[model samples]
Target: MSDHGGSGEPTPRILVFSTNNISDPGIDLAGSRHLHYPATVSVLAMPCSSGIKPSWILHALQAGQDGVFIASDGEECAYLPDCAERTAHLVTVTQGLMAEQGLEPQRLKMAAVCSVCAEPFAKYMREFAAALSTLGPRPVTAG
Candidate 1:
């Protein structure tokens, strides 16, 4: 599905899975600061990035998201010490699954977004939006 919004051009939509304690604050700060990012970007708050299911990533892509970004907690996870490693492993697994399903691996990305990383979050969103635009709209499939 494509949302042209009367512009006659398909806009790239991104689904961001952000850690509640670590990344959500930064994302919210970006918004409060009036930082520019694509309006089509949506954020979902999760307790931890490593807890995200691989299936959820595929589901988001298949459900029409042009890309999925994980706002990881990195080495400063409040819930788990090895959260970064676990999240990386899940990202790898999810990418492999995407490849098997004929999806571009670049469509999935992960980065650290600390509580005070408003600028970085905004930058990441802009970069992801550009990358998705270059990839074009995702091909729709019939269920």
Candidate 2:
């Protein structure tokens, strides 16, 4: 992570898993509207949220991401009718795994983002960034 304007505080690095058919458009709309959100966030678009593996989330943290956010399709999913429920279960399972690895459960978050949810997407990012700032950088473990 890089310093925040040389304030000596490390900027949080967030990884977002966005659904291609739903959340991606919302995120794009947020960007197109010039909505303010932290630049530290990096999005990876996938086919669906429910397909995300628990190990992938842990690997993101282990690989130096300060936090992870899942932008789910909710009821607007094109792939599965129960995408929201499945994604919620995935979050729960991943959280448990995170706790077992000594990671804070709050470091992970999830929210439904529809195609027109630009404001909500931006809001989520800002809020997540603030929460991550409060948590500080992910602890550097000695290998």
Candidate 3:
């Protein structure tokens, strides 16, 4: 399914999955701080970044999300000793899945976003939106 708004205007959408322990606060702070980002961006909070499953990312992509951004807990992760590695591994695997489906791996991005990183979170959101704009809509799929 393709979406271009009713007027055919490109309103790139993103599916953001954030770890609740660390990254969730940053998302909240962004709002409290009045950090502005695309209203089209949607967020889902997760208990731990390590608990993230690559299949779900694929499901969002297949469902026509312009891209997927994973907000890692970084050093603040409570469940895993090294959240970065696990997140990287998840990204790598998810990218491979995207590639296998003929999708660009660039559509998936991950970064360490702490609780106080409202600015960084907002910045990255804009960046992701821009990147997705350049990538355009998800590749036309076969029926």
lDDT to native, each model: 0.89, 0.90, 0.87
lDDT of 3 at 72: 93
Residue pairs whose backbone atoms clash in candidate 2:
none
53-141: candidate 2 lDDT, tens digit per residue:
99999999998788999999989998899999999999999999989888899999999999889999999988888798998877644
**lDDT (C-alpha) at residue 54 in model 3:** 96
- Give one digit per residue, the lDDT tens place, for model 3 in 1-143: 23444546576889999988789899999999999888778899999888889999988887768789999988889888887898899999999988989999989999989999999999999898888888877894433
lDDT of 1 by residue, 61-106 (tens): 9888889999999888999999999999999999999998888999
Off by over 4 Å in 3: 1-9, 140-143
Candidate 1: stretches off by over 4 Å? 1-8, 140-143
Query: 109, model 1: CA deviation in Å?
Result: 0.3
Backbone clash pairs for candidate 3 read none
* Candidates ranked, most accurate by TM-score first: 2, 1, 3
The number of the candidate with the highest lDDT is 2
Q: Cα lDDT of model 3 overall? A: 0.87
